[model samples]
Target: MAEEKKEFWRWTESNWKSPDINWNDAKYMTVGIDVGSVSSQAVIMADGKVMAYGNMRTGSDSPNSARNALKFALEAIGDMPEDRMDYCIGTGYGRVNVPFADRSITEIACHARGANFIYGPQVRTVLDVGGQDIKAIQCDEKGKVTNFLMNDKCAAGTGRGMEVFSDLLGVPIQEVGDRSFEFKGEEPAAVSSTCVVYAKSEATGLLRKGWTKEEVLAAYCKAMAERIYSLVERVGVKAEFAVTGGMAKNRGVMDRVMPFVGLERMKTEWDTQIAGAAGAALFGFALCKKGKGRKK
Candidate 1:
């Protein structure tokens, strides 16, 4: 918790790598700011190294969240020469509200760009399961978004859903994976409800039925798995996949996704988090490579 919180404050690495920015070729490095529904993130690429990067919680103010996320990145750079900053790119729901951003991009493009950059050129698909949204994107070899799909209208199978379930079982979000891992027998919870509000109601019933916490968690995993597969299936279920965003941190979901997709085509590495941040940082490098400039 403390380490995650520190990202919002600034760069703290004792040993920082120099980004491979050609001083003669370009000016300032590029910045990527992702202001998500529940959290905000920033990344800076200078020279050949990721100069500074950080993420902070997004409170009620979306605009400030975007600005603060960028500021946090600067803090991480720890006296990084300000003159080197050449361009700024913003994304996520709050992108349009980031006053300091030179240009705002759609979250879909941002996620796709971010994912392709982190996972490498061969990444064919990305399951960006965010806090309040679910975005599935396909990308080309150059890290450009090809075809994508998203769902933001509801709250089923998202980070928010997990938080609610965590509270119902009296478990912290961090403890869910370990607790679920401890169970011996299979006891699934009844989560027939899709809407978040209704899911809460159903979770309460499962609690009343004396379902062990692990069983309930497992059931919830499959339930969310159901929703996630719907999106993955839409992208036509391809190989070389990646999953990004905050919820990508959930071990249970990570444990469940590849099996549902099948190990033969899945290629193993499914459970992940912060792939979005990695992607954002990679895009920052891209913009720098292109000698990009932006205003307004």
Candidate 2:
């Protein structure tokens, strides 16, 4: 589980229509799904707002996980008309296997789309912390991404990273964020080792040596945040760096992150975590519009 530098890749379709599309048809409702390694999200767009959003853990197989996520969101949407549900867009690691989608998009694009939509025009860099992947994206004025980097292979700075530590600390994952914000000084322990296996083992030694649980956890958080900061800095650290993805909810990560940056906003808007799904929903709506144009 060592920290590995990875790519923040972005792919946009200039003429992205899948040959399977029948653009002559028109539909009123749209849906999007973002399938990540550890979790999947689904969203529905109707009535000028997101009608439903559902999130679920991805099982051993990712395709099933994508279906399960979409099923959950469809259930949440209740009663949208079947004929009007024109498009289903999919993004994320498992986007290609999302059989129901009209088009598959890169997670980077979806994240940018989702962040720009939620945070408006100000966001230039997006920091996304997924369950199994973490990415830092740089985008221009129109929410179109310019460059990106991703750590799809590691658990060092992701939701899974926190989960592992929570288990070690006997802290619930939901509350880990709240508790980490209470620490008072530089952590006595340094979870600085690159490999998670080594770091976790080192963490135990720190605890056995009489280091308070708070300091050890704080140290771990700091180390993890520093890793994320490196990725953000790679994206150039523009004024409005917004954060999204599952790990965005962790206060521990945020606390350690805020004091180190000179950007206008240290943390990202809360909804950015759901940016991938939201972008999918918007992309679905775009498909519906495309269908109308072909008929005219």
Candidate 3:
């Protein structure tokens, strides 16, 4: 048999719930669905605390993606509490398409709130690297967005860029960070960060010139970091910088970007990708408490 091909762009995903929460006893129940260009998430909150969540790759159909995310979350908790939900909020690129959402909020607001929830009230800044865009947000103590900047014109420094590089190097997406560090000697020059096409061409040339895959990886990662640094500069980096979205998991990129931007990474045990959905759920919880839910 021919050697099996390696897939470098696939990322890890999961569904989880807090084991400590008693779903039946909660006074209020809310849900948040975040449907982005490349992924979708459903978050279940009971009385403002995260009870469960489901995340998956986005498919061609937005409504189905939203429904499937909720289905996965409900299955994880062994319950069908759809009727019990007091409010449901939708957010992200496909927010409006969420069939059951009572309201829609922007991903910037959701991400700010989610970061504040995970990193605490002290979080004042967020960098979200989504599949098709990159966002740098500044928020207040209450997780309200005060200012933000985004780069969506190209895929050079976003998750898609990382995926492209991983596929080219034949390394798993999760391992791209570690593989980048394997390169010894002087750090390679940064590649073009203006466009993924140019960067890909540069990588190919580097490989043809006897550069190791690790060296090419280092150059690509550095370029991505630098590109993001430029975008974040427009928003003005405040302390307590928290990174969210799919790219936060890439330490290879974060390791280079954090230093380039001059800030310490906010540590968190929660899944970074769920910030937007979790924030939307928190908003739903707040709205429910205010008796503003459409269900009411």
**Candidate 1 accuracy as lDDT:** 0.68
Model 2 poorest 10 in a row by lDDT: 8-17
- Candidate 3 residues 1-296, lDDT tens each? 99888777978668998999988889888899999988899999999999999998889999999999999899889865678888899999999999989999999899999999988999998999998899999999999999998777777798888888899889898989888988888988888654788889989999999999999999999999998888999998999999999999888889999887788999999999999999999999888778787744
Put down candidate 2 lDDT per residue, 56-131, tens digits, no spaces.
Answer: 7767876787778766765554444444566777899888988777788899988988888777778888888887
Each model's lDDT comes to: 0.68, 0.71, 0.90
TM-score-best of 1 and 3: 3
Question: Which ten-residue region of model 1 has the weakest summed lDDT?
Answer: 6-15
**Relative to the unseen true structure, what is the C-alpha lDDT of residue 291 in candidate 2, on a scale of 0 to 100?**
65
> What local lDDT does model 1 show for residue 289?
68
Better of 2 and 3 by lDDT: 3
* Candidate achieving the largest TM-score: 3
RMSD of 1: 5.4
Question: By summed lDDT, which 10 consecutive residues of candidate 3 come out lowest?
Answer: 287-296
By lDDT, who's the top model here?
A: 3
TM-score of 1: 0.83
lDDT of 1 by residue, 1-296 (tens): 45442122221122222354333454447777777887777777654245556677776888888677767767655666655677777788777877777777787877776666666667778888887888888888776777888999887888777877776777777767567666675546437876678777877778688877787777787778788878888876566877787666667876777777774323323223335544555565666667665532
